[model samples]
Target: MKQLPLPMHLPARDGFDALVVGRNDHAVAHLRGLVPGAGVAAPVYLWGDAGSGKTRLLRALAEQHQAQGERIGWFDAGTALPWTLDEGWSLVVVDRCEALDAAHQQAAFALFVEAGTQGVQWAAGGRLPPVDLPVRDDLRTRLGWGHVFALQPLAEGETRAALRREADRRGILLPDEVLAHLLTHHDRDMAHLMAVLDRLDGFSLAEKRHITVPLLKKMMAENIHDLVPNPPPAP
Candidate 1:
């Protein structure tokens, strides 16, 4: 099992359109509705395992909200800014809520309480179900108060489909052999695969070459230092 970067830059592939929903269509729908300020009062709580596209969904929605000139507050467990519900943010997205420590959990709970009163829309995700969340009990309950959808991983062929779609979007023609090599040697998850695509796109542009197996192999060799030998445990 070869390793690539733990996380590369945000993939150019995002938004509802970029997502290849299989069993997680319902989750996608609810999130898309949130982007348009659909009248669903309850906040959305999305739960899924790592590489299940939770981060992708959250970032996509945040981007949509930003595009509409809406005030959006996006927070990840690692970089949660100080937030107060009274800030008049239209949408608040909190990812990896389960990883929040005690102080951040308190801040999140405050935000949730204010969001309820202000009717601010919320889209959040965690690795664990709300009931099983390690955060404060009230916050856990609030996480599940609204629509809770468990995002499913892509089916067998969906990964390749996503790679092809992203390649098309970037106007790069990736060979089948390169795609097969990724599926066999690297992370099959869409997040990681998209990251590789992003790197490949940049590398091709910089090196003035088309995307091919040999090019990809060279890029992988050059990026071997980005690989994580022993990744941290997921929440």
Candidate 2:
């Protein structure tokens, strides 16, 4: 049977400002201070467990450079490109270094060497510190050469405060009870919580009701999925 494509998600907002720093303020600050193509001596390496915002931070840096009219080459473990260094690239970002296969690892190592020689700023993220990464010895050493930051997950209180901030930004009146219920009943990751808030806002609007615990329950009972529409299949 032919497989139906998965729904396309809207790109999540990622920037230093959009990030909830939690206990990772130093890491955020380092990335914020980086000037693309400024002859940075080494790559900034970030490591954290799943949902710890490693990917988000990398993307945020890339977006910042791109906004400044710098050409960026971004690669992840799943990137299918040949991973050759482009002379025009002002910055290069590699995410999910922990998941790289043999070929991708080789490609990443070569890209790092070329980027270093050509004065291209680079950053990388992974689930483990360079010393503990399950990659080649030389590549692991390269990963550890620069500033290494271990991202810490937000505490429960921090997550709640972040949700409240988002609600305020969206001009939504989120009640304490409803917020508590969401924290108790759903995934607590910032991304998942934010998506829940988005869906709840839409559901409340559709039902012509103010957001409340009852409204949240009704929305949950109906098992409302992401309100974002799926994109058309590729030709």
Q: Work out the TM-score per prediction.
A: 0.86, 0.82
lDDT of 1 by residue, 73-175 (tens): 7776887457666465788888898899998898888887777677778889999989999988888888988889888888768888888888887677889
Worst lDDT 10-window in candidate 2? 1-10
Please give the CA lDDT of all the candidate structures.
0.79, 0.83
Name every residue pair that clashes in candidate 1: none
Local accuracy of candidate 2 as per-residue lDDT tens digits, 1-235: 4233233333456767877789999999888878665656568999987768788788889888888888889999999959888898888999999999999999999999999988899899999999999999999999998999999878888888888877777667999999899889876666677878877766766777889999988877786444223345779
Clashing pairs in 2: none
Q: Residue 12 of candidate 2: its Cα lDDT? A: 53
RMSD of 2: 6.7
Cα RMSD of predicted structure 1: 5.0
